[model samples]
Target: MNLFHFSEENGIEVFVPRVKENRKNMPPVVWAIDDVHAFTFYFPRDCPRIVYTRTNEMSDEDHEKFFGLTSSDIIVTVETDWYERIKRTTLYRYKMPSDTFQLFDACAGYYISPQTIIPQEVEPLTDLLNRLMLLNIEVRFTPNLHPLRNAILNSTINDFGMHRFANAKGN
Candidate 1:
């Protein structure tokens, strides 16, 4: 399986394990996302995003409520303010070997490695919005994500990821 690490900065020769501020209790580790879910990270590092997919577990009511009239199975929402930055940002996709990494969250396609890693290759990705569109991902711009975040939390949409929410507006 192909594993990747996305970053706004380039020239990353090695990845070292480090504890995240919010995940202090967990052991230090290098995080990577599998190819299947890599599209979710195609944005500025701190840009807040909420991604959800239509799953079998979703009820008819919830489906219509969240995805009414939309044919796309995956939806990615970001704050309107970040649109300009996203258009200008270029992300470096670092290909990492899978030998030292283990699945961290299957649903999120997240993997973790305790050992330091040197990327096999680094590819720069531009035209972020177009890239997401090419993947058939529906991108929504909102003034605030709290409402949708709250609604999803209270709904049956389990296949979702809310990232960097603290950076979201009105957080």
Candidate 2:
């Protein structure tokens, strides 16, 4: 399986197995976090499909604290270019947050000196873990879509086939 690690400016890091092993019998399922409307795809393959009956009912203060931002403010910017990489890596990106956008620096990064720092904790456990479960499942040895599949939307793709098409189309 492939691994993906992302670090945010706020000392938050997210680690996930980009690709998970797919299995029979118990496939993956998509779960929605009602409060934030964030959806997570999970693989129930051989794992207990626990029924989280608890309501996603969070107080305004709790919700704001969880995300560290207001509802209308920029909580997290899911850039289009960032989704481009995810689409290539995960195949599907059209899941949550309909407000998708493209940014120029999505794939550009430079090291600041030679310093390394360890982080204390990461945010979005519920969001990341839920999405991870889905990513973990639906992974197969061959290129075949399985249950609970995902893809990115409104993102750039530079794959060989796509590149050929773009060259021909001249976009």
RMSD each, Å = 0.8, 19.2
Per-residue accuracy of model 2 over 1-171 as CA lDDT, tens digit each: 111122222332322112223323322322112222222122111211111111135444443443333222212222122332333332211222212212212222111111222322334232333253453321112122111012111212111011111112111
lDDT value for candidate 2? 0.23
After TM-score superposition, what is the CA distance of residue 57 in candidate 2 from its true location, in Å?
0.6
Q: TM-score of each candidate? A: 0.98, 0.17
lDDT of 1 by residue, 1-171 (tens): 999999998999999999989899999999999999999999999999999999989989999999997999999999999999999999999999999999989999999999999999999999999999998899999999999999999999999999999999895
Which window of ten consecutive residues has the lowest lDDT sum in model 2?
158-167
Number of backbone clashes in candidate 2: 10
Q: What C-alpha lDDT do the candidate models reach, one value each?
A: 0.96, 0.23
Task: Supply candidate 1's per-residue lDDT for 18.
Answer: 99
Candidate number of the best lDDT: 1
| Candidate 1 TM-score, true structure as reference | 0.98
